[model samples]
Target: MTQSTVPPLKVGLVGFGYASATFHAPLIAATPGLQLAAVSSSAPGRVHAAFPDAMLYATPEALYACDDIDLVVIATPNDTHFPLARAALEAGKHVVVDKPFVLDTSQARELIALADARSLRLSAFHNRRWDGDFMTLSQLLAEGTLGRIVHVESHFDRYRPQVQARWRESGAAGGGLWYDLGPHLVDQAVQLFGPPATIWLDMEQQRDGALTDDWFHAVLGYGTMRVVLHASALTAIPAPRFTVHGTQGSYVKHGLDMQETALRAGAALADGWSADTSDGVLALHTAQGVVEQAHATLPGAYTQYYAQMRDAILHGAPVPVTAESAHDVLALIEAGIASAREARVVQLRGQV
Candidate 1:
């Protein structure tokens, strides 16, 4: 029998909040081999307004029951990730859960095992890996431009002094800045330097009337190397997005990826869409003195993630972010929380 070409993968997105509306849906629509077939959202009208042709389901259970959906993207609240992903996997659909894959490693491992048993692809949306500045830093590290890295600092600070009345700002499970932004920083650090030997964390509720923690500083110790990840809601003057120090030099980048701002502003994907205009400073020590030069930022490609996911489902390519890698990030998050609660450094036992 002659083999037939498989049609585009039909995707059902769970949730229509900032992550789904601003990132997942848009990228899925833009990718070549994926179709935004349906969505499960509380606000059906909003989903229709944004994606006029998409079929809307009132609940994820209904969307999961639909036979046409080949893939499921979970962009709901962090606490809802585990159950929804498990259900999607049980339905025999490939899955993509947004970062902080689940609340803990056990839940992640369960989903991983189920997906593997079903021979389905499972990925985490660690989109910041495609950030323009992070791409540049990856290149520098790979090329040995920074020599032996000794210390690295990453910040995801914002100036939201007023606390909003939302689940993220409430005392609910999987709420707070650590669960909100800590995954990005922790994932980036793990990508750069693998799992740390020890984890130390400090967290606080800095803003007035803040119910959950809005500030966090985590230190991932890799023997001689130290990776510092910090995020806060009350940072009026935010620090550099990334700072790296090595035996030979230092690199500091000052801006976040532009794609997010553009997406929030209802901008479409086009030429130069993810380009970062802000240049980073790279300082090298020379015989004469220190030489500082501005390094041009690389163009971010968040859409590449969805495209890769498509290929992984259609052509047996590797998923962009593996379930195991995401599990490692979750382990780090758990360790950080424990360290904060116990006021001691938590030791990691196994590989990421």
Candidate 2:
């Protein structure tokens, strides 16, 4: 059948929170081969405001019960991810859970096994993998422009001084900066260089009302290469989005991707928005001395994820973020927490 003749995959989004509304909902709606058919939200008006025609359900189970929903996207709290995903998978629907795939690797492995047994597509929304800066950095490394990478630092710092009352900050089992932001940083690192050999972590409750760790610093060691991942709610001055050093020299870039901001402001999802960042600076060590130049960042196409996900359902394409890859991310997160608690470098499983 021709592309135009193929039917769109109907997706049921299971939450209307910041992640769902700001990222998942609009991206799914804009993808050519996907439809935002139904949503489960307590506030129907919230879903209707952005998607007036979308079918609304008061509870997630109700949405999962709809046979029309070919795919279920879980955008709920960290602790709720595994249960909601299991329920959706048990309902015989393809599943997509937001980042920090699950609270632990065991949960991720269970979902992976269940999906494989049922022959269903399972994926994680590691959207930051498509960030403009990351895309550019990937290209730089691919082209050997940075020579052999030796040290890398990635930060996702924010400036929220006062902690809000939310499940994410409630000191729950899966609530903390490490679980909240570490997945993105670690996933990006694994994308550039495979899983690390060891990880050392340190976390702190820096904010006044913080019941959970609001700041975290983790180091992933790969042989001679050392990567530092950090995030904090109390950061005032901006840290480099990425600071990568190689035998050639270093690459330094600042500022977060603007796609999320644009989406929050209701910018129509389009290819034009992929150019969401400024040129990053590259420093090279030359015999003459030090040479620095501005390197153009590539456009970040987050919409590709939903488009690819649609193909995975209809055309049997590989999932945008495979379940195994997300499992690795969660494994690293668990290791980081253990490292913080034990105050030592933790060796990653199956890595010698």
Tens digits of lDDT, candidate 1, 1-83? 21235577899999999899899999999887789999999999999999999999999999999998999999988899999
> Per-residue lDDT tens digits of candidate 2, residues 1-352?
8898788889999999999999999899889988899999977988898899899999999999998899999999999999999999999999999988999888998999999999999999999988999999999999998899999999998999989989889889888888888889999999999989999999999888789999999999999999999999988897999999999889999989888889899987765876854889999989997799998887788998998888888879999999999998888888888899999999984942
Per-model TM-score on C-alpha atoms: 0.97, 0.98
Which segments of model 2 are wrong by more than 4 Å? 349-352
Candidate with best lDDT:
1
Task: Point to the candidate with the largest TM-score.
Answer: 2
Off by over 4 Å in 1: 1-6, 349-352
- For candidate 1, give the lDDT of residue 269: 91
